[model samples]
Target chain A: MRSKIGLLVVFTIIFIIPTLNYAFAAGDEPGEYLDRRVVIWNLFFRMMVVAFTIGAVVSGTMVWLVWRFRESNPNAKPTKYEETGEW
Target chain B: MSEHGNWAEWVYIGVVCALLVWVGAEAWNVERLVEHVPADAEVIKVTGQQWFWSFEHEDGTKEIGELHVEKGKAYKFEVTSKDVIHSFNIHDYVVLIDAVPGRINIVWFVPDEVGEHEIQCREYCGLLHYNMRAKLYVEEST
Candidate 1:
């Protein structure tokens, strides 16, 4: 249990902290392309980055789950049928 | 669904809560001009008709189809409509305001680029909505 907490803290410091900083830095870099000098552009760029990151993670997880439970794998068998009795 | 899943569940909830806080903070800080408009900001009165846009400057100058503004200067647009509701939209600047009859909507923008930008009606006001268009000319400030 202590090891798990330690791993979470290390993961956050090494990965999550850098990701947060990079996200903020990414927002400032798109000002050159925006037409108006508005802060909304920076926020918009940041939103898009976060949204895309979430979408990629969700889609990747879905793909992995589908592949893991595919019919091709002999170990991936169906659990119980709702219509019939125990088999 | 396991007996020893409390820690993992708590971690998931914590992460979700953090993400929510981050999103809420970003939204709360979104740039919006509610009041205290700069005194030196150029005021442009925009009146939208069924198929045309009219611009009026503080100097009593009227311009149709094209509006000229100085680059690097702040501008506040007092937008309204003559007959129906129309959306005054400048795609490049990401400025959009509803021009409703009997009410004035105010939106502001600072032009940082000098060029001709296309303006169009984003709302379907009438049959000739497709023809309702204008141009914005941003010139270098003197």
Candidate 2:
């Protein structure tokens, strides 16, 4: 379950990053683009890239941690039985 | 003794796959504004002030609070600003254009869905930036 969740996070970031950049960057009038608009769009696109990269890195790290540290038998029955003195 | 007993893992995988597919479909379905705009409609001049928008439609008609257009016709917008840089974004029609000073930005979008749409300033202009907004009313036949 944890692995699946991690994969989901990775996919979501991949899907959202391009659309956000395209929506914010495309469709300016030809030869009339302003420096301010270009600057703002570039900044916003960089921010999105940073955010998605961080999310992907975190999810990937979590997946690796789960693979390395997860219990071998999460639903195992306890075997540390106590002895009765009367018996 | 069972090697594949984690049904929860399968469920999680299914959910994640479904969500990814959904996002992909949504990204694919985003509509473009250029295809909907007409080729031969009148032009409108939009100028953004500090906290208000003033529009000058074709035929020398000046109006505020309401932007009227004839249905089934193409309309072009020449957007600019009076003071600072502002982004003109219409929520429903996928029309987003930057309105800058000393330059005219041309955008063409048709109103196929006749109703009132909200026009907002997407860029952070000034102190009253949050309150800068306007309306676009798509009317039938003039």
Candidate 3:
């Protein structure tokens, strides 16, 4: 449980830190193309950040759930539940 | 299992809130950029056809493939299209305005520095949409 929490925090910081930096580092100065490019790049960057954040959160949740409630019946024998009929 | 359900709900809410905050902050920043247009600039009417751009400056100077503007002056670009909808995007300046027929979309910026900026058609109009490009030349005031 502690390891899972640590992993979640590490992943969160790794993904969120860059997004925070990018969000704040967007152009604040006035220049010819520099500021404009920064703005455009910021848009694309933010989109990426959002995607990464969502992915991290979803995957993290899945990992947490798997770790928390995985199959504890280690001694149970495998049942023959194969599908043999073909269409 | 039911004990963890509340925790899951909290995590879901937290994620949603974070996303909302992120989107809101970005929207505010972009809105600020869009609202501010410098004064003392000329107006240029840019019309996009199938594969080219037509530029008309305030001084009645017309050109194709190249646009010229004086440095340090704000230039208002009135963008429209002749055929299908196209987006006039200046990648370096981060200016993008959709060019639609019968409607004028306006974007303005001051070219404080003198250089050549590349303009591209952001919307896919046809097979040769990638070939649509124009140049913006910012020259020192004569």
Candidate 4:
């Protein structure tokens, strides 16, 4: 369980590091084209950050649920099973 | 372990709230992104035909297949189509405005450098649409 948590944290960091760098590293110069481009690109970058944040949260939740309900846990109950095909 | 799971859920909730706030801020700031035509901007009439573009200056100077403008000045292009719908696009300037028949659409841009830029029809109008293009020359101000 500790190893699983460690791996999940590492993966989350890997996903988040570059996003933070991109968020802060926007070197928009002063020009007619660049000024207009920066406004659009800033919107795109912010949207990307929101998307990545949502992805990280959802994926982290999935990992946590899996770890919490693993077979080795004595107090965890069995998950409901559904048949794949209809007879 | 149950406590840890609860904490993780709280973190996820916080992240979602932050995302919502960011979206709201962006929505409220939409006006800053809108580009308005200046009152003193130079007006140039542009007509997009089947396979070529025509430009007319305020002084009645007409140009076909090429447009000339002075650098460091904003130009408002009033565009319309002669036959079918054609899109006026300049990749270097990132200007894309649709030209529809019987309707006029205006777009403005300022060229800061002196060079020749390619003008293209983004929408497919006819068989010769691939050959529909023009040149925009930004000359140094006298």
DockQ leader: 1
In candidate 2, what are the lDDT values of residues B35-73, reduced to their tens digit?
233446579999987978889977799987557776656
Which lDDT values do the candidates have, in the order given? Answer: 0.81, 0.71, 0.80, 0.80
Give the higher-DockQ candidate: 2 or 4: 4
Ranking of all candidate structures by their lDDT, best first: 1, 4, 3, 2
Report the CA-based lDDT of candidate 2 relative to the real structure. 0.71
lDDT (Cα, 0-100) at B89 in candidate 4: 92
Residues A1-87 of candidate 1: C-alpha lDDT, one tens digit per residue: 999999999999999999777555543321222234356677778989988998899899999988898889777876565346545
DockQ, candidate 1, comes to 0.14
Model 4 segments beyond 4 Å from truth? A1-35, A52-78, A82-87, B1-33
User: What DockQ does every candidate get?
Assistant: 0.14, 0.04, 0.11, 0.06
Q: Which residues of candidate 2, in runs, are more than 4 Å off?
A: A1-87, B1-38
Of the native A-B interface contacts, what share survives in model 1?
A: 0.20
Worst 10 residues of 3 chain A by lDDT: A78-87
In order, the B-chain TM-scores come to: 0.85, 0.72, 0.86, 0.82
Q: Write the per-residue lDDT of candidate 1 for residues B8-94, one digit (tens) a residue.
A: 779888988998889866765453222235556788999999899999998999999999998878788999999999999998888
Per-candidate TM-score against the hidden true structure: 0.74, 0.51, 0.65, 0.62
Q: lDDT winner among the candidates?
A: 1
Highest-scoring model, TM-score: 1
lDDT of 2 at B12: 75
Error of 3 at B72 (Å): 2.8
Off by over 4 Å in 3: A1-34, A39-87, B1-4
